[model samples]
Target: MGQFTPESLAASGQAFELTTAGGCGVFVAEVHGERLWIHGAGAVGSKNLTQDGLALFEAMALAGGCRFIRFETDRPGLVRLSKKAGFKTRAFVMEKEIKKC
Candidate 1:
């Protein structure tokens, strides 16, 4: 929403906008290499992202010939959405090195 900036989007690639006439939501995707990544997604006054959002992603993948899609967000709700949309989660480890000898 208001959190995005033209400069930020320009950094990723060419900028564009699409509104779903309030029936869905607004999302921005940029083609990275051969994949289109969701740069932003939002539905005003809605707690959950619109189903159209999912469709938009699907359409992009199909059009771009993307065989895989990757997304990560800090929002737990989004994680749930991803799961509901047929995604699996994998646990990973983070190790830090302590150097003092």
Candidate 2:
């Protein structure tokens, strides 16, 4: 959700609308070679995000010929949820904020 916008997603990724048992939302994914880079997903404020919804996106990626998918998130809840949905941690991400001190 941070630094991602409609313009940005439209610029370089494939956008998908989703309707699930929970509710409706959308996601943006881009094919980075054999991997589908899931840029962002939004089903906020409705209790509408579910595993089925995530799987729906995954299905789309597979049908589009992606061998795998990847994304980044800082929320613990999201990480737990993704793990439950069979997503594994392939690597650790580290970052630091630079200041012109």
* Cα lDDT, model 2, residue 95: 93
The lDDT leader among the candidates is: 2
* Per-model TM against the reference: 0.61, 0.78
In the range 3-90, model 1's lDDT, one tens digit per residue, is: 6575675566544444565454555566667666776555564433345566567777778887555555667877777778876665
User: Candidate 2: global Cα-lDDT?
Assistant: 0.76
User: How well is each residue in 24-76 modelled by candidate 2, as lDDT tens digits?
Assistant: 77778888888888776776434346576667768877898988878878878
In model 2, which runs have C-alpha deviations exceeding 4 angstroms?
Answer: 1-4, 45-48
